[model samples]
Target chain A: MNIDPVKALEGKVERLGKDLKALDSRLENAQTDAAHEQLGLSNQLKDTTRKLGRTNDRVTELAESVHRLERLLVALNRKVRAGETRKADFGNWPEIEKKELAKIFQGQEAYSRKTFTPQEAKDTRKAIAEYDRRAHEAIEAAESLTHLPANAESLWRKHYKQWHAITDKHRPEVPDDDTHAKDTAAKSAGNEAIKRTRQQIRARIEDAVANDLLFPAWFENAMGPAAPPGRADDWLYTATDVVLYRLLHDVTSPADALGPAPAEDGHRKTLYDRLVSECAEYRRP
Target chain B: MAADPFARLADRQQSLRTALRALQAAGPGSPDFPALLTTTNDEVEAVMQARRDVEAARLTTPNRAIAAGTTAAALIVAVGWFDAWSLLSLLVAVATAASVLVDPAGRRLWEPRARTTVITAALAATLLTPLLHGWATLITAAGIAWWAWRTQR
Candidate 1:
């Protein structure tokens, strides 16, 4: 080894320079990589943020839909209850009509039995015609108003058809020269059948009530504590006749049997009271 | 509106109930009572009509096909566990199938919970044979019975 300190120092410095260059290159490369990684991370974060915003919007929409559905459910529940009450009220019409008819017929019958002058009889007939017209009008109103279940409607239709047949068979005719006797015979036969049918219906109603199969509280209230002792059958038959007339034909009320003016105030007032109560009950939840 | 007839009927029933409450609240004295009553009656008719429609709709072809598929799957599972336990599973599967077939509307049959119960029982029977021994099939019957009871309630 000759004395070459300067040369050796130069070599050492050159090696150090190379090492510094390499280090600098590594540091620069690392910085670039870090920057790329940060960019990637930023993009990912932005994507995630966008997705989160969409998710939040969706959740808000779903919550609104649930609220709407809840409101609908509450409204639907209330409607069902009201419909049930209305159905119950319509179901009561048959019983109410039966009770009212009973009173009307009883009044007509008592009047018919009393003697009256010609003028009074003519006035009575006119009143009877008016009552018949009213009865027909009531029936039309009921038919238009009532909407019964299928089974009940079918049963009603059958009864209506039977009533039409009975009325057609016994419709009164002008006393013609030759057909007067035949007309009388037919009327009597029809009346007998009507009476028999009324009796049967009354019996069935009584049986159903006695056996607790029916609980016509309204009917019982309308009938009051007691019907006149011997006139119960008459009352029932008269009511049945009223129903038949209402269903099928308009027949004169037996106002000829009624004296000058038939007092129907008691029966009318009682019926009105019962109707008001029924209406009140229908409104009760 | 619900596409399912039973669901439609339920909606109509709910509407009717609401109308009835409104009718009651209106009272007979209110001038609006008559109008409310008419609305209530209309709702009643709608409910009845919906019920009739439900009855008429009953089990459609798709429902029948699904029921048949379920029955076949049940039977296949039952066969896989052919033993004393198989009889119990088979009985349950057959009864469920029969009920689905016979009922006018397979409303309960189509319920997600009911389907889940039936499938779970079948899966339990299939998977738990080694661990539960013959008791796995019993689970099938019990599951079906529980589902039936729940539906009835």
Candidate 2:
């Protein structure tokens, strides 16, 4: 019995479209997951910026306080050096010193009306000085976090190389272009449809992963439950790695145009660098 | 200005125009070229709008301190002529003070070089009493206000 080739081809194309439509749903789910993760990161960055602004204000206040304290101390020392007071008055000088120190803590608006015992002023100054020191340390830490985007990029690169190796394992070599040209059967509409469908799936997956729109479900399904203390970063490594590997593995021969191949390690590094650079917009300036 | 986002958007706009032109030249028959060209044009417009938004966001509203500073500078230079606070001088001060205040960005309206020039002119004007020194200061203040307005644009 002779089979109608075009009719059979049409049936296959219809089935292929249905499969791709299903894959599209999964891609959407992944995209949603990535978007949520990005939102969390963005919120965290904003929080850090707010904290930085407050810290800057505190630093300014501390500097101002120190200046005021120095002036007060100089005035007190000048009065003492003038020898206008008797030695008997020296015992009560500490009380005066305490009052002056306390006045420094009270803001200028309320300073004249609000009375502070010498003891309270001394204690407040000590406490505020300690707070200022801690604030400086926090500012240092926040400054260091400016490098967080670079760290994320490096972590992603490491996972991508691992995924690439795993996916490449035991895979059949793709047939060469000359061989494909000779095999007319391989160039049929069915093959072309399959190629186009595959390209679309690959692109959607890459877009979802590259833009960090991939949901945790994409990673959890592949990597199992993430190790405890699961941050968005944990899934990020796996989701992007999977997408990158699939993208590289599914490309047509002409698309393998990564220029000349290097040593295996060098080739992976080149690809990693290229992929990281492509996603530079997501990274810090 | 060094980290201005609008400047970057403007640069993107130039590149986008070049790309859109190339795609448009590909003609309508080519599959995807029409869609690509349309998308590129949309992106260019988006960038242009964003640049405009950024410019609008940073638009310098008149600042009271700037107006006050201008009047103070005017008075400082006018001190030698009429009564330092003569009716005419004070009126000029009040009127100029009522004028728009210019906020600082990039080089300041009262930049060091401008400050030195104004101070030198005022000092020289002091030698010619009658407090005609008002013109030099008035002119200097006007120059600064002009510089600031230009910078904001």
Candidate 3:
């Protein structure tokens, strides 16, 4: 056991080196673990985003279905106001179909008669407006998280200031064009203006990131387009859009912005025609 | 308005908790096990997708230019000065030039085709500079040229 001191010291150094190497590997593993933790957090956020999108979609579908039911009630109300039978309005429907529709309408009248009066329609409009407000608020809240890269805020401020200066000097005046009668010329001008504005928007975006704006996770979760081109036949009109359109046009009922209900052959159908057609399919023999 | 996704998610969790409680209360031989399992699976998938979305969002780089531009344009509509707008044209031109110069990852600085197009556009702009009068024309010409070159290539 009486070993030389030099040899003993060398052995201790070798053991220390081995321990240091082991510690280094463990440290590397720890670093990797930290990276995985970061990834885990990011993954959790993504999961939330997807769930939100699904929920939003489901809600939109439910809203659209409710809107369709409301439309049917509204159409019935129109016939009642005109003092016309469902048969008279829906001419395309077979006699039996008209009767069936009448039965359906009458049954629906229990619900519609109570809540679908003109006053109720007005109330519905108000509710839809409120809903739109809430949606916009939520969207804005979600959009608030829109991340900007370094130096983006200052650049935006500068652009905002410049935009103020430009728009102040050149105010777009289209008061006359705001009327119900669609002015093609004004519309074209407005479109051109939009194009210009979009160009400006693109330029600003380009200036900021030299890339497309990062679509926020919440944005991805926002409800999908309600009216896809394929389903143009059964246009799922949201109550909000319909009410807003009617209000803006000062019309009793909103025009189906999603192209009017499908026409027969080459002839376009009126709202009355559509009501009849809808009634025909459900008519009883 | 659609139900807020966050709220909906919370509701879903609450529903799951309620279901789990019901299953527990019903004793060991609860017939709802299969349905619960299916629902749990769906939830897991949804959770996974949400996680993926989160990762995607993190990965996405925000375009500061667009944000600034949109903000500026919106503000202009709210409170703009039309007379001094032309003065800012120079600034816009400068911005456009700077944007082109600062291609992401310095790609524009490296790519040969991009360099050649930039040179050609600069030459064209220089030749037309005297006639065009303002930096607007020069910038516009360069931009158009660059865009056309890029698209064509």
Candidate 4:
């Protein structure tokens, strides 16, 4: 008896289809079991994909954040190295003075209410729609068939074959002559452009975080804080608060927005920095 | 003014085109893309979970209400109109009753992934299952009341 690989693959596929069907009925009586099983899986996959996207977005966004902090770190490092600035300079941020940071809460809250571009709003809607579509497909698939698409290698192979074949087909044909140097140069150029965009955002943070500089109009637009009529310190602290506040509330947690948390309340620090703070607050062994 | 306006317009168009091309480079299914897709996927799923929570919440209430309504209707018919509730109607009523109890019971109790409280509630429902038809009504009321209190607070 000849067992062809293709036939074997087909056999596996047929078996999967059959098993998936059987899983359907048994799963029905244990219906919620089956339903949620798919729901969780699909949601997980969808989430993983979305998370992957958001991670990319947040990373990119926070790449801006990182660059901002890095520039602050760099400038602070440079200042201390030059003996031109001290740790006291960081403490001098207007945000450090409670009254100064508090002054900008009004502006930051106003910024929060500001409408996102049609694109940003559209993206949020798109994320939601993509999630719903994939989630429904996952739950429905789980209910209809048992051979999990996620785990079924043979079926997945087939799925990959059918859906994953687009790359070669759509890929722009490379010119015969090598463009590696050109491509590398172009990428380097693009990287520099990205770096500049990043640094623009970061320069402000460095200004606020390290140098205690405040340009009210630019500060308000990018970092969301207006300078008090006379004090630069208020503007600086306000910027820090706005950035961190946006990270904690709008970007991460909605629960923080709901009611007074009272304990930690809406106040949270970066995990990395929080660890540092905790260490500072601890009694020495 | 027209030349200045046209130059500004041209520059704006060039900038807008540059931004769009950048986005196309970054769009979904873009090769070697960052993992933001996965985060978006998760947030999407969380949203989906929120939706499921709503549906699950709906099922828990309406289903038990269905049992309560049927039982009330049966009693009314038995007392007001019919000599006795027909066996067919009785079976449907019992099935509905069982369904009401079973829905949340399955979700909260029977589900392998059920939360501890839901599992506890399910276990409580199970212990009361022998008197399920009537007990289902009480349990549902309690669950709903608990939900309302928690939500309202």
**iRMS of each prediction:** 10.8, 20.5, 18.9, 17.0
Model 1 Cα RMSD, Å? 39.9
Put down candidate 2 lDDT per residue, A203-276, tens digits, no spaces: 55444434333223323233322222334353344334434333343322332222234445543455555544
Tens digits of lDDT, candidate 1, B1-153: 898877876787677667656755664435675576567656655655565455446434434555566577656665675667556655565566555556424344223344445545655554555456566667767777766774563
Candidate 3's error at A191, in angstroms?
40
List model 2 lDDT by residue over B1-153, tens digit each.
225655655555556556545654553335565465456545544443444334333433323444555556556545534554343434544453443333222233123223233333333333332445344445435544654454453
Once fitted onto the true fold, the runs of candidate 2 whose alpha carbons sit more than 4 angstroms away are A1-285, B1-66, B75-97, B102-134, B137-153
Tens digits of per-residue lDDT for model 3, A173-216: 21332232334334444445434433433343233222222322
TM-score of 1: 0.24
TM-score for chain B of all predictions: 0.46, 0.33, 0.28, 0.39
Model 4 residue-pair collision total: 30
lDDT value, candidate 3, whole model? 0.39
lDDT of each: 0.50, 0.43, 0.39, 0.41
Question: Model 4: per-residue lDDT, tens digit, A167-249?
Answer: 22222222322243444454455445434433443455665445534333323343222232354454444444434444333
Which 10-residue span in candidate 2 chain A carries the lowest summed lDDT? A86-95
Kindly report which residue pairs in candidate 2 clash with one another. Answer: A30-A214, A30-A215, A31-A213, A33-A215, A34-A213, B81-B131
Best by TM-score: 1
Query: Which of 1 and 2 is the better model by TM-score?
Result: 1
Compute the lDDT for candidate 4: 0.41
Q: Model 1, chain A: how large is the TM-score?
A: 0.28
